[model samples]
Target chain A: MKIKTIPKYTVYLLLVLAASIPLFFDIKMPNKPVDSSAATFKSLMTLEKGDTVLLGTDWTGSTRGESKAELIAILRILMRKEVKFAMWSSADAQSPRCAQDVITEVNAMMKKEGSREYKQWEDWVQAGFYPNSDVAINNVGQDVKKMFSPKRGTDSTGKLRSVMESPVLEKIQKIEDFKLVIDVTASKTSDFHVQFISSHKVPMIFAVTGVMVPETDVYYNSGQIAGFLGGLKGVYDVEVMMDKGLNVPDKDGKIEVASTKVTDQIAGFPGKDNTGSGSKYYPTLHFALALMIVLVVIGNVEMAMARKGAKNS
Target chain B: MNLELYYALSKAAGVVVTVGLFSVLYKENKFYRFCEHLFLGLAAGWAAVGVWTESLHTIWYDRMMGTVDEAGKAQSGGHWIYAALLPVGFMSYMVFSKKHNWMARVPLGIVLGVWSGQQIQAYFDTYGPQVRAGMKPIIGTSGFLVPGADSGINPQVIAANVYWSQAISNFLFMFTLVSVLSYFLFSFEVKNKIILKVNIMGRYLLMIGFGAIFGTTVMMRFTLVIDRMYFIWNEFFYKTLFHGK
Candidate 1:
């Protein structure tokens, strides 16, 4: 049979094998974090303990593979630094649940490792979900206290109190009061944030899907966002940075991750649970990519041969 | 139900449904249809409950009727004015009525009015900086390459002077931007030869951008497939069924 006439199911089966086989083997691929990812790490490292930040969790199960990893990595950093964050969603009704699940999973990992388990109302708080993306974000930018006053969170006593009374948001009278704003999104909520909140001169960061990287780069280049994490590659970059810090040398005087974008040396959690979905799924993704490249080359060669044969006949 | 047993059963059901959905790759079947309908129904039901509990109950109902503390003391007074919004929101459903269809436009118009007002400010907030950032110095003042550009971009040293490499990069970016903008000259006939060539260049540049986007999209789709494989093989088969967690 001609290479051009390969059965479709055969290709699908090959893809399934290529994708699943890599998970069985433990492989660590050499990686260089991109400039944008390096910048995002630097921005996160700049946050100090007890500083509150606004997090917009605007992703659902549809983009869980990437968004979940991104959220876990960022949450690890925040929990390690004891940074307080108030998270809400403006994209979908299910986004808050997806993000909360990842947080719970990360907290479980931390608990298993004998680390501090981040608690609600003290370390972090959920501000709930808003349906209208544009108007919700606009209302947030206009009057944060007024917008969140109606929403309630449980205190240490387990009594429902206004979200404004939560420790994470008590000091946050306006959007500018927050140290930073982060949006992990698979939708247009990031654009809405730029429209309303960026004008307030608040520092913003985004962790977006692969398709959003190109457009998000425009915002990064224009100085609208301080930095951004893009796709699985971005997640992998953060994972590597977390394992070996940027421009920081180990006890053996070896710098595993280095970047010129940041001059100050930042240290990483060396002996910790740093690896997540990014580390696990990235190498497998490479195998799938290689299969695609091989198939493309074969298809091209087959096309040329078929054209030559038709002309000669 | 036991939590462990519940989780195990959940994973087993997930595996069955996943296989059922994948059967569509072979041929159209009832299993695929069943899974599709199940997913739609679940999503719709969840959204309905989520909207009411997460949003409407807290934001609207609580605010309108106010709330009481455990001691039976009034926490906040009820706002009777908020009750008016109910009818206005329900007016959106008037589109189904033949006689009162025009009333639906009122709420839509209000939304549009609010949205358009915000857009006027949002337009500048979003695009103005991008336009400003487009302006770049095409002349090099410093060395051929920025100090640490080879290792990684050093923001400090590069901000003071435009290196030769940056100049060339900036020139290319500017050219592409101008050419692409010129390509959208749809008002009049393009008689100018130089513009026509630039228009062609614009098309090529646009194609390159679109190619990069398409490549990223393909990578994203592959990641999704790989994630599903991980879920099926490792998450379900190895961990749950074989007790390998």
Candidate 2:
């Protein structure tokens, strides 16, 4: 066989190696925060300390590659702003647990940094998994209190209490009362939420995997969603904005991190551990893509050379 | 088992399962099938438990049977009217019965009615804003780029000052939207040459859209594999085995 027609296993091994080698080195990547991501960051920045947001987490380990980083970056920003949030899931049974695990991981990172620990009941509440996203989401829009009255959480004193009674949700009588609602999902939960909740006048955003990007764009462009983090790039957008800030002016009076939606540069946590999945996977993805392109070029070149030789022969 | 021991065991089991699933890439094997079955079983079990704990426990069971306080006294009064829903829900399962298959339509009809009732509002809520947004003006008055702009200027004013560049983009958008809509006109023979060209343009535009979607899907799939690789090397090898930082 020709060099270009290498064994399938050899090709797979080469691709794997290409994808893995970059993990060892720290690559400096240029960050251009998209307008949509900037809008999402701007929306979150608008929330004052102690203000509440609703988080609909509908992803499991399946899409962890993209969703985890999104959750991490968004949570880091939310935690840094001292913004309290209430979380729930409607797509899958394990989604709530997945959210719990990510939050726990992020909290540990926060603890290591000596930041204020985000307390349950006091700061945030987890309204465990709910079935039937459409009706449940509609219920959330119609009767927020009754919808969440059943979910329980632990107070500061370790006492089990209804989630609605928690500081994170005590004043949330309706869906619109929450400063914003963000859906981090791998399923159609974002659409269901849009159909039921966003229609009720609540500002919404999405943190979705890449495949959902094209579809999610319609919502973002339509103004139904405040903004969105689409796929891994969206995670990178959050990371970049958090590092440099949106529309922040440089020493030369130039706006460093520019975004169409944002007016002025709001600074991000410069030195902290804001990098997550996007940071880690992005460079490796480049290497894989480069390999794919190289293989395609080589194959085409080989085929062209063969055709030329045959004509001459 | 102790917490630490349990954690180690869980990690080991996860590694095994991950490898088992990945084995299919090499060749068809029992390991892959076992892992697949394991996932399906776990998902089924978890969903069953979740339905009771997350849904039925509060929405139906507690609502119908009421709740008791710590002292065993009735805390919330139960409404027995909720019991009627049980038969309605159970009727949906009659889809499998030959004799009672028609009864399944009762629940299905109710579902369709509710679903149909919500569609009007749902359609408007979803597409109303989109349709409005699609009406982009193909004219501009202000300069191409707004320099030194700050938060002082009203966004509406800025939006109103559409430049030639913005005008061209909007014109392109309007054209694409119209051409795509025109492509769906398949009722009559399109004799007009202009209409046929527009129809072809729509087909080409749709292909471009699908191409973009397919590209994104490819990226997503690659990211999934990259994540698995990260899990294997960073989490399993470096952290779990070598205890590397």
Candidate 3:
């Protein structure tokens, strides 16, 4: 059977038009912060100054569209709160560079705002990449200090030291000591972290791509994780919550966006807003999705008609 | 127009490459192929540089040769222990040679040994807590069915605590978990009628789970396209190129 082709030039024009139309018109879509995103935002907001969070950066450039935005948003919140963090990668060898690039961008943003610039050896640290994820995670759970001893890197002053010696990691003895474990990933490393680290009673959250949302919901329900931000919608939810703080009792004294879990009751502080990928991407996603749905319907109708004509013949 | 201009040009090249690869959606052609091969070449080049900068130079060479003091660059002595890793790591390259392939086993065996030792404790650490948490109380009097704020009540009153709503939900969860676990019983035939029915139901439930996964995947792809649109319009045109921002 020969497949009918749309004229090649026509197809090119259509794609360019579809991609460019959304840009020409300043399309803005309203977003309601979902429960999972609310949980993630509140978790970050609740962290105290000097508190340390473990960031598992398990994404490479291939997922830059989703994962980069997720990382930047989370880092903005963490930096704003003055929470120190240690980053490590177990997913891919290239992940550490991606994480470093994000940190550099965030630091530049901080500098622009005249806020406290996150220092490499002091405020935040890179624990470097580990080849084996399961072994690395298990080792970290058992004894974080011993597991990371072999990995060494140059400090800001060009002095070679083991990652554990950095000021960010000075007091962190075990996995439970960190305030939260945020896994920003495009892979199953989040599952590995949940199984290994969350079992140690450490608070866990996920910034995952869209496809992983359904499977991740199970972890949220089972209390294996504190909360989740799944795909672009998850990103948008965090952005909204950041812009308009959650649990601010309205004029009627009724709490908006109530939580079923223990940590959801904390009252959110208003103002000091910052928007990232979610806010930027979510509105355009609606247009793209609508186009996809229309295309699907058209293709199905055409297929049905073709089958009917064959039957008649 | 020195280093900064060069940097800007490099970024522009990246943008061009991205557009070239994406052009394949119109129709597969030489432009897409060129962009794809360019990406591969750049990635290989980057990887070579990355290994030296991130791994080999810092971890091995720096430790082996030692370092100098900051003031007037006074030399320091080398640590000879780092030399041992050179031979062990080099053994991994034997994988390329057909006859010497068995030599590659030395490094692989060591990695496997370290990985295997951690698995015993890792299995329990990962799954044990989840299994424990899955067990839920089948009854609650704190307004289970109403889906409102929990009405605080004393734990002492056992009879009053048994809310029909809470019991039903918990019963459902427990039932589903058991049914799903039973579905995996390949050791023996499911002779019992009730068990077989439960197993069949479990299969359907799993399919529902897969459907939800598919939905999420679709949403994610929409998000990626949305982000690209945002970049082209908001960041590139409005903020950077056309608009003064």
DockQ leader: 1
Q: Where does candidate 1 clash, by residue pair?
A: none
Question: TM-scores of all models?
Answer: 0.97, 0.95, 0.85
* Over 4 Å off, model 1: A1-4, A250-254, B149-155
Question: What does candidate 2's lDDT look like per residue over A1-313, in tens digits?
Answer: 2344667788789888987888777886877788789888888878789889999999999999999889988898889889999999889988988898888988998998789878878888988778878767777888989988877667887766678889899998888899999999999888888888877788898999999999999899878999999898898888878887787777877776786555555778888877788888888888888888898788888888878877798
Q: Write the per-residue lDDT of candidate 2 for residues B1-245, one digit (tens) a residue.
A: 89766766787788889889978889999989999999999999988998888778877888898876556777577899999998999999999999999999999999898878877867787788899889887987887765333445765677667777788888998999999999999899899999999999999999999999988898888888889888888887888777787
All candidates: interface RMSD: 1.9, 2.1, 3.7
Worst 10 residues of 2 chain B by lDDT: B146-155
Q: Which order, best to worst by TM-score?
A: 1, 2, 3
Q: Write the per-residue lDDT of candidate 1 for residues B170-243, one digit (tens) a residue.
A: 99999999999998999999999999999999999999999999999988888888888888998888988898
lDDT of 3 at B94: 97
Off by over 4 Å in 2: A1-4, A157-159, A302-313, B146-157
Please identify model 3 stretches exceeding 4 Å from their true place.
A1-32, A111-114, A146-166, A252-256, A262-269, B2-4, B56-82, B137-172
Chain B alone, model 2: TM-score?
Answer: 0.93
For candidate 2, what is the lDDT? 0.85
lDDT of 3 at A179: 96
Residue A88 displacement in candidate 3 (angstroms): 2.7
* lDDT of model 2 at position B148: 35
